[model samples]
Target: MLKFFYEEIDFKVPQSLKTSKWLKNISLSEGYKLGDLNYIFCSDDYLLEINKQYLEHDYYTDIITFDNSEEEGKLEGDIYVSIDRVKDNAINIGVSFDIELRRVLVHGLLHLIGFEDSDDDLKQQMRAKEDECLLLY
Candidate 1:
């Protein structure tokens, strides 16, 4: 089950059904099954509060993912996205808001699939994977 929620934001994911299918395909390609996935879109302030409360990080981030899968090879989690950051990133990266939003969305999913970006090499790999997945979108 893939669901989307909003917090301090009125935006809805465009072409949500298509987005859901594309995400499911990404999971399948990574040898995982889609389970319960939730996307929570919010303002920068709202996400900042969550970051401080849960992660103890005082900085702003584009997304935060919590992996909650109990079964092996199943992807389940809550992905919180900051629309404010996404919009700013889109401008800074010279990409459309839609494209950057999708990138952030899949970045969270990739984390749930065990991809990490804590190091330079891992960050490169993650970016490569993100680009490849973007092409499929």
Candidate 2:
């Protein structure tokens, strides 16, 4: 199951049903089954607080994913997205808000799928995968 929630934000995800189906398809294509995924949309400040509390990080990030699956090859987690960051990133990168939002959304799923960006090589691989996933969206 995929669920969406908002915190300190009054925005609704556009085309939510289509987005959910696309995400499910992405998981199936990656050889995993969708378990229970929750997406929480919030302001940068809200997400920053989460980061400081949970991760002990002082910087702002677009998304923070918490993997909750006990079984291998099954996707389950909470993905927190900062709408403020997404909007700013869209403008900074010359992309539409929807496009950037989808990128962030899939980026979290990729993390749950075992993709990492802690290094340059891994970041490149993750970016390529994200681009490929965007094509499927």
Model 2: runs farther than 4 Å from truth?
none
Clashes of 1: 0
Q: Report lDDT per candidate.
A: 0.97, 0.97
Cα deviation at 107, candidate 1, in Å, is: 0.3
Residue lDDT tens for model 2, 10-86? 99999999999999999999999999999999999999999999999999999999999999999999999999999
Per-candidate TM-score against the hidden true structure: 0.98, 0.98
Going through the candidates in the order shown, the clash numbers are 0, 0
What local lDDT does model 1 show for residue 130? 96
Question: Against the true structure, candidate 1 has what lDDT?
Answer: 0.97
Model 2, residue 72: C-alpha shift (Å): 1.5
Q: Over the stretch 21-134, how does candidate 1's per-residue lDDT look in tens digits?
A: 999999999999989999999999999999999999999999999999999999999999999999999999999999999999999999999999999999999999999999
After superposing candidate 1, which stretches have Cα over 4 Å from the reference? none
